[model samples]
Target: MADSSPSLDPVELGAYFDLIEVTSLLRHAVEQQLREAGELSYVQFQLLARLGDAPSGSHRMTDLADGVVYSRSGLTYQAGLLEKAGLVIRTPSPDDERSTTVTITEAGRERLAAVLPGHIEVVKGLLFEPLSRDDVTALAGLLAPVREHMRATPPRSAAPRRRGKVS
Candidate 1:
């Protein structure tokens, strides 16, 4: 007789798939709406939002990159585009000549304010309205461990490689 058994992977069985799907769907919906608003990419909107929350309407480029998951070069490129559009400005950092600071322009603030209502509606439609109060609480609880793990683990550094020399 042969044994029949089932295999279970708890991590896989848990929230990963649902989280990924929900995140992707929400992002897509929000991006679509923001794109239609005519001046901001979703990323640009997020950048502006971050600057709006900063103490002086500005942030160090490195800090902004970390907040938005962009690399330094990536943020530079995005900031350049935003500068050209009059939505943001890059200024020399007083504390560090090597680093630049980004500030949201008045135009950017106005643009974000204009689209925020629609964005919030889309977010509610896609992510929130469908969920009951209990579902939201359950999701928050379920995600806490994943969020904590991500925060606790430092990003991996590249390992040194052995050099090959002619014998």
Candidate 2:
């Protein structure tokens, strides 16, 4: 359990709560759009979109998971789904035989192309419609460093299983 003592000042703590709420709202909205448009989950769409956008149209599985903020194990599942759909293929990594690579297929590209317009619209509506130019810039500037730092650590969902009992 967290200590009762507050680590941040009241205003800062409130801001954190606000950020969490806003993020959830935005995520829910995007999920709806994705589900309706292509029956895709956010992570699945993220994988396809990233692969589609990759210069080489492929990325190592671990790299893809990190980039998309998914756990490595979860990414494996999503990748499997994409492969089964004929949207992508998982194969031996040319750079390292021990690792796998995910490459977007024509079908994957087509799927991404199909969903992108709706995705962009949803983003603009939920995230950009109210923000002024300066608001957008300032928000990005404020968040970018924190995002970069967190990117160094894999998310809990994707972290390797820990060998320990819960308290």
Candidate 3:
């Protein structure tokens, strides 16, 4: 006996494919510009920007990780790289020895300031420049619900586990 199931419509699948392709293209464009300017990766730029925007240019590492989309271990690794580059420094939190505080160095601030204008221009060109004011407002409105839903949902655990043999 043979089994059959309905296949996904090509048109519907193409929409999802287009979405991924467009997002990848935009990321690639931005990354290329950033690389031309310097060695900063998107994640590094984001982390520095976060610290730069914080009060006193400092934040707890955990809070920084939470605000950004990186895993805790990933954040630590990146922070280590930033520290090695002398763009950031880590200090033991006065209130908690277990927690470390990260601060943007003068070098970090200068680097971010230099890169920011170009980054903004690229963002405007790739994303906002094409949109009218009303279109930008509408796009922001459309994304709000999804952002809220994501914030409301807690993240899952990242624990490692052994895989078992399947029957």
Q: In order, what is each prediction's RMSD in angstroms? A: 4.8, 3.7, 4.1
C-alpha lDDT (0 to 100) for residue 119 of candidate 1: 94
Q: Which stretches of candidate 2 lie over 4 Å from their true place?
A: 1-6, 152-167
lDDT of 2 by residue, 1-167 (tens): 87898489899999999999999999999999988988789999999888888899999998887688777778999999989999999999998997999999998888888888999999999898999999999999999999888777755546667879888
Estimate the TM-score of every prediction.
Answer: 0.81, 0.87, 0.81
Using lDDT as the measure, the top candidate is: 2
Candidate 1, 1-167: lDDT as tens digits:
77578654887766668778989999998888898885678888889989988879999887887778766667788889889999889989999997898999899888888889999999888887999989989878988997787757542222233478859
Better candidate number, 1 or 2, judged by TM-score = 2
Worst 10 residues of 1 by lDDT: 153-162
lDDT of 3 by residue, 1-167 (tens): 66577666899699769767878988888887777775788888888999999878998887787778778888999999999999999999889998999999999999889888888888899889889999999988977997788977564223443479768
lDDT of 1 at 60: 86
